[model samples]
Target: MKVAALLIADPEGPDPCRLVHGAPLLRHAVAGLLASGCADRLVVAVPKSALGDCEVIIRAVPGAGSRCRVLACGADRAESARLALDAAGESADVVLVHDVARPFVPPATVRAVAEAVLAGAEAIVPVLPVTDTVKLVSGGVIESTSDRDRLRVVQTPVGYRPDVLGKVCARGSDPLSDLPGSVRTVAGHPTALRLTTAFDVAVAEALLEEQG
Candidate 1:
């Protein structure tokens, strides 16, 4: 099965291009996906202003030159994902929508999601069991508590059949819940933590140090 990976390197966020472990976070995401050997092609969606820089960064990865394609993204994440999916084109049978912020996603997790899709699962997402106590609050008042055992923290890269994903994108529907087929889960690694703040960056740096 031919699989394609899509990454949205939105600059407006916590700066995906920020250095992590001596390399840009976007570079780590690209490199990890490539290392997975699951994606036959990769399409990265970046802001128009940062297209050149993003392209350069992706090309700098050891094996990305031939398989990676960088392009200007749309106004929002949904649009960016749609455009990237279109960029993946008809040739790609499976597509994985990944967050560039989660740069340290384990290659094995990537392969597992892809393998599930290839093995007849229509849609798959890597998820970790939620360990924290859940709460529902409104107006700063505690409303209810959620069952942690039944809750899972969703992670990327989310795998899907290209056609299924295309339909969801066209309707502007929620990919996780509105997907036409059943969504399954695979074990996610803690290393797949998303870098959304300075604290996350610090944690990722520490993780890198530990791995070394």
Candidate 2:
């Protein structure tokens, strides 16, 4: 099955790009996709402002690195992603959306999501089990404890049928931040390692080494 990966890059050289995490993070994602050779095509989109930066990334890689077609997209995340979809053109049987911050997406997880879709599920999301007990706070009072098993910590590389994702984008604005939990769930990869802050990046780096 054909698959596409959309990387929503800030392009302004955000903290994710700093020496600590940025370059390594993108490298991790691209390397995995390249190695997987799972998708017929894989592409990355950065804001027009960040095109130069992405180019620098390609230049550093040993291969031609042209497999990932980078683009200068709109200001918003959904817009940029939707633009990538438009450019991808083929509307592959399945489409996988990933974030640069989540550089540690395992190839196994990628295969799992694809399996799910091929198994007839329209959408599939990857999530890790939460280790910490969660407290539900209501009106400043502890409501109750939550079952960690029932609650999964969603990760990125969420797989969806291209048509489904495109339709969702058409119904509303490009998928943006502050989406509902369910919406977020649809966007996680089972083996995803999100790099939001400095600490997250370090954890991801450690995980990558272990994975390697």
Candidate 3:
């Protein structure tokens, strides 16, 4: 199966070009995907202003020359995803959408998501079991306590068949939402944590140092 991965870097979000572990976070994501060998093609959607910078970053990754394409993303996440899907084209049988912010996503997780799509799963998402206590808060008051065992924290490189994703995108629907087909889950790695705040960046840097 021909797999295509979409890496999105929203303009409104934290700077994807921010250096982490001696390389831009976006570069890390692109390199990780390339290292995984799960996709036949890689389509990166970045902020309009960062197009040229992103192109340079992607080009710097070894073995990314022909397989990677960088383009300006849409205003919102769904639109950005749709634009990337369009860029991925009809040749790709499976599509995986991932956040560029989650630069430490394990290559094994990437391969697993793609493999599940190849195996017959209509839609796939890697998820980690929620370990924190659950609480329902309304305004400032705690409403109730819920079960955490049934909860799962969703992670990316979400996989889908090309046609299914196309239809979802065409309708402007979130790909992670309920779709026409069943969405299956696979084991997620802690390294796949989505980076958002400065604290998250600090944690990622700490992880990198520990690994080295």
Question: Top TM-score: which candidate number?
Answer: 3
Candidate 1 lDDT, 52-159, residue by residue in tens: 888889888999987889888787777788888888788877899988889999899999999999899889999999998999999999999998999988888999
Between candidates 1 and 3, the one scoring higher on TM-score is: 3
Superposed Cα RMSD, model 2: 3.6
Reference-based TM-score of each model:
0.93, 0.81, 0.95
Report lDDT (CA) for all predictions.
Answer: 0.85, 0.64, 0.87
Deviation in Å, model 2, residue 150 alpha carbon? 0.9
Question: Which pairs clash inside model 1?
Answer: none
- The alpha-carbon lDDT assigned to residue 173 of candidate 3 equals 78
Candidate 3 structure quality by residue, lDDT tens digits, 181-211:
5789999987788889888888878877787
List model 2 lDDT by residue over 3-53, tens digit each. 776666644434333554345555666666555566656667765655777
Question: How many clashing residue pairs, candidate 3?
Answer: 0
Ranking by lDDT: 3, 1, 2
Best by lDDT: 3
Residue pairs clashing in model 2 are 16-22, 17-22, 48-72, 78-174, 126-190, 155-188, 155-189, 156-188, 156-189
- Where's the lowest-lDDT run of ten residues in candidate 2? 178-187
**Candidate 2 Cα lDDT to native:** 0.64
